[model samples]
Target: MHRRRELVGWATVGVVLCALAIPWFLWGSSTVVFGLPLWLWWHVGWMVLASAVFWLFARRAWGLGVETADSSERASATASVGDGGGSR
Candidate 1:
């Protein structure tokens, strides 16, 4: 259930990012931010946002389990190796 919620949260973030990337939202704007046109700023902002979202999703969804699984597998393999070449 927790994982499902996390996936849904990520999906919501993806949808928002897609919506923000649509040019219509930034069209007809003459403002400038940080020495860049508004439209360009919008895109740059979204790019940064997308990177952050991806990092969060990767860390939460895959990072922890992969490390734990790898460590346990290594431990089991070492134990088997120590058991003397098994079933010769």
Candidate 2:
């Protein structure tokens, strides 16, 4: 399940990256916003989208391939530390 979710998340990131790379849709557009061309605006919006996707990835799946101790293990370790690591 973890592997599947990771694959899907990364796939979404790849799609967003590809969209940012190509601005074919705006090639014929002459629209202007604020002072910039449509394509420039497209880039800005795409960059914001990419940042959001990356933020989600960082929040949810940033620990790819890294080993982490289980919660139970952590609890036991904390208990051991609280006992000074010596027999009473």
Highest TM-score scorer: 2
What Cα-based lDDT does every candidate model obtain? 0.66, 0.67
Q: What are the per-residue Cα lDDT tens digits for candidate 1 across 1-88?
A: 3434555776787798888785586578888877988888778877988898788877656543344544544655766644432322
The candidate scoring highest on lDDT is: 2
Shift in Å, residue 57, candidate 2: 0.3
Cand. 2 Cα-lDDT: 0.67
Cand. 2 TM to true fold: 0.57
Task: TM-score each candidate.
Answer: 0.56, 0.57
* lDDT for residue 81 in candidate 1, whole number 0-100: 47
